[model samples]
Target: MFRFLRGLVLPEAACDEANNSSRYENLFKKLDVNEDGRVDIAELHAGLKALGIPLGKDAEETIFKTGDSNKDGQLDFEEFMQYLKDHEKKMKLAFKSLDKNNDGKIEASEIVQSLKILGINISEQQAEKILKSIDADGTMSVDWNEWRDHFLFNPATDIEEIIRYWKHSTVLDIGDSLTIPDEFTEEEKKSGQWWRQLLSGGVAGAVSRTGTAPLDRLKVMMQVHSSKSNKMNISSGLKQMVKEGGVRSLWRGNGVNVIKIAPETAIKFWAYEQYKKIFANEDGKIGTVERFVSGSLAGATAQTSIYPMEVLKTRLAVGKTGQYSGMFDCAKKIFKREGLKAFYKGYVPNILGIIPYAGIDLAVYEALKTAWLDHYASDSANPGVFVLLGCGTVSSTCGQLASYPLALIRTRMQAQALLEGAPQLNMVGLFQRIIANEGILGLYRGIGPNFMKVLPAVSISYVVYEKMKQNLGLA
Candidate 1:
């Protein structure tokens, strides 16, 4: 991007350079913090953050590498001035792109149009709110100087990248989960921060799943076997499991369950990006419908690829000891007896459940985020760790509540579909049978165990992710 920006000589840059010298000097003084002749990484990072245009940890290093010609690890006045001028040139180009008519000013409509081109949809009011932040004179529009000053400290050369950062870092209280694909900046992708974030999240998820394996297995067991006559309460369920197998049986299916998370996340995120490009409108617009379809399709894509593992999970979770020695043995026997189709036993209901789960999860999370920003913006844009965990737990619970019946049906199919001479059921038929035979309450048979796991799972995942992010230099 900068290479393209470099090819164009700013026609007025040299002519107006002298007149802007003092402006550059004052800006340099402000960035230097201690009034020193040189600016360090700390000062630059702080300045950008304070201005609410933070470019993350990699930006400071990139700036020094490009502008710090002396290689002394600091940006002196000359280096600073040079960097700002080049940066301003790029910012000017971005401004012109948003200006649309080459009118030397940006209106809210243009802001909306530019964002749409970047595949982000926002109302005109949202665009106006954005403009107000940079519209220094309150004319409800932004001119060259306002745009330049607003982005002076930001290292992003493109307007889209800037918005990406703003969206993720501010009002960004999210737990580590595959409920939504994580968004990354171009810098994060290029500088390797994206993988660090993913790795952290993956590690967090593995630990969380492992930590909650017992409850997860119990949930599966309750979903499959718990009925009115032999009502499986928690204590009795625990006793029954330990009595049937050893204490270790509580974590029966967790290994395959945890192992599938990484590949599942990778596939989902990759599918989401591709779907965004394909589903974007002629004008590159992405509205809520696009987001919902993309997210649901991505979830389905991930579920499809890892569905064999999912079947294994449900089977192992509910399997009695010695029924199948392990995952591979189980898979081997199923392949031998039931053929390859057994691996995707519950795929129909599983796919159908993705829509409600994704929709409710995203809607709840977004509503919570907007509520947080409205009530707490003056206090801080970022929510605390506990609040984030709570929100994730609530949002996930809501999603699960809306789709738990399908989940129960999916589990039942995955576990019971292998029975000899049993009638197969599609998602619709499974829904009807479960409601008719087991009653509506049967749909939520395992909801207690499921709810019990959310808090601990989210807490463990969030804490591990935060620690990993810090270790990876993302904090």
Candidate 2:
């Protein structure tokens, strides 16, 4: 019985080896330009280029010398295999570097120091955050098993594979303790499942906005009335809103707000895909600059398409008692009273704010991700979820800081018509008026509530998005 089993297993193992040999032979053929059964420097360079891996002359020469195991000027099949084996050895060396003191575990301090060597400055707090992610035993360090498991699927190469892995999207690193869906297969993508994804995103948005509706309403109130005679503090604002409009009034404009999410998410994602295609190189890779440009343009496109809903949402939120019944009533009244342009009340500032917000957010997030990978992620390309959330929160906050004044201007303009005896001001006129009347601080009137909602809102949104993705079988 043992002999029979061995015979069966031996044939299967031989077949597997044959398949690997066939794959390597094909690669060798592709690299052998002159069909000489070996790869010279020129042929190797061309082969690497064809594989979307560009190397400088010095790097190429170094690789060629190392791969020429027989001391020949060219790389035969045996030498090429040696080069692949060297990659595995390099990965082991990288792990050893992280395993300082030869303890077979990497502590947070070691990670922090390693990142410093890579020119990535990180705080001890940030290092702890990263360790908390992959330290499965709550020991604040990564054992060999955990480290190997975390990076089992990642290519055993250097930063090149890291860059390629993150080239698509940074969704994985957007929230604390949230697990995004894995990368989609081409078959799943081409199967007309976009609507499902959009539906999931829209549902997540609605839930997040509704959960944070009170803060959002308070923000609008502060934006429109905090500088007025009302002098609305958070408590007074809540009391005033509740006394006048009842507790349910806190969600006044939430209908239109939720309604706009579907199209906005769908359009932004679709436009991003199109822009990526436009910006991709011949090898279908997009650099960081191209990714930022595509994201900014996509955001602008979505915001433009959904500007009317934004106007309606603000109007309904800041409207007086019984000013308009609902979304349609508000829309009709605005169209009749202020003309078609009313729907685009704050269009300019809104569009202008997109540039800084998207730019800063993308830049900070990418820098943080790259730094984490360089320092904390010894052999792994995946930074822990906590690291992503920390990076995302900081980046989003910075983006908000850079663009808050524009946001305040946009909000004020959206609610302008609702304010009694308020003069209509153009974008520049409004900035001047706010500066003159309330000082530059007027632009940050509701910023407290605005910031108050960021963490919970983002956390809830990401959690729901992941859950919905799973339910839809898209995860």
Candidate 3:
């Protein structure tokens, strides 16, 4: 049996799955670090340590005791997997056995009976609240499937880790738990620091310019040709752009975009700073909730104030086919044709989206920076440049990926404003049209180029901005 299993299990590369399964499997292996076919208290402690889990021994023991089934003093791989797979469900199951009624669900009455049998303590109100949350269908009863599915496919693992880190980290009392080496010179820090800040800022600027440019182009094309009412394929649209104005046609609105980047960056960075300061302390330490609030508000403030300029930029980019004379003409035309409201066509989704985008982006970037700092421990090689690059890649990727759907909505809404006699499409209609015409992937049109362009570009921008501030004694 051992030989057969060994033969079946090739090396790590061979065991890799084709999709997201590989990620889960890798996480599982990290959790099962000992390769001992089971996880005991010692093994669990070691695994937690490897994951940077900083909980106390008592807390660790509580988690382990609840996780280990059969009271066998150790948990086998299967038991460990089961415990991880549906933690809440498994706990409830242990309670459910006490119910003595095969109702295929758990409720307040059920909880009382179940807790009684398990000799556990819980009040009626608590039981009711728990039951309601787990009910899934608002039926006041949580069936096995609902309970299992909720816990089994839980993607809140990161959130849970964040919670754990927050709790333990609070006790550490901030003061550089990680150390910087004496040999690391001030010159090196200076070189890396200012360069990284500028690079990171530039990246944010470039991505903001580039991402909105193509979509602006598309929206304009849609608007201009709305009178004709012909569907535009991604390819044909490109062809039309090139044919109408030569090779430079695709870059028609780039001038306006170039100018817009500075203000957009200023607003975004400024708002982010203000909001972060307001929500957090001087050291810029914040919990998940605070991070979310700060980020969201930052995005909202920046996007809302700069939206008119954004609209102007889009018009210029998309007016390649003689739709509008130039940025000035486009603005004048819009103001004349549709009034000032034209500039703020899709402000609702645009403003609201900033919140989550800022929150997730900042939260992820800051968290990644902290983690990298922990791992590298103030090594000279892990300069501000490296930090900016790493954080930029993560933050930009997360922000763009999460914001794609809303972006599509904003695009359609803005396009609708420019297109004469074009059928008015709500968010649902827009999604349906995209699905029918180009499939689900249509909504994520520029995600690939967005990711590729963002990482290095933003890194450099950030490096430059930070270093500039430091040199100017403004930081």
Top-lDDT structure, candidate number: 1
Better of 1 and 3 by lDDT: 1
Residue 245 CA displacement from its true place in model 2, Å:
0.5
Worst 10 residues of 3 by lDDT: 170-179
Model 2 pairs in collision: none
Residue 34 of model 3 has an lDDT of 66
Q: Write the per-residue lDDT of candidate 3 for residues 350-454, one digit (tens) a residue.
A: 665665565566567667755654455331213255555666566656866776666656756766765567677766787787778677766665444345545
Whichever of 2 and 3 has more lDDT, that candidate is 2
Candidates ranked by TM-score: 1, 2, 3
Cα lDDT tens digits for candidate 1, 302-365? 8899999988988888777898999999899889888999898778877877778878877887
Task: Write the candidate numbers in order of decreasing lDDT.
Answer: 1, 2, 3
RMSD of 3: 19.3
The per-candidate count of clashes, in order, stands at: 0, 0, 32
C-alpha RMSD values across all candidates: 5.8, 14.0, 19.3
Tens digit per residue, CA lDDT, model 2, 1-475: 2122223211222224465455456667767889988888898778656654455443466567567877788988988766754654565566677777889888878876766554345566666665665555567787654553333224435533322333334342211111112233343365544666667767877888888899998998898899855689888988999998999899999898888876777677777888878998886666656766777788788888989999998998898778889999999999998999999999999889888887787678778887777666653345756787778788888888788898889988998888889998888999999899888888889888888888887788779877987787656
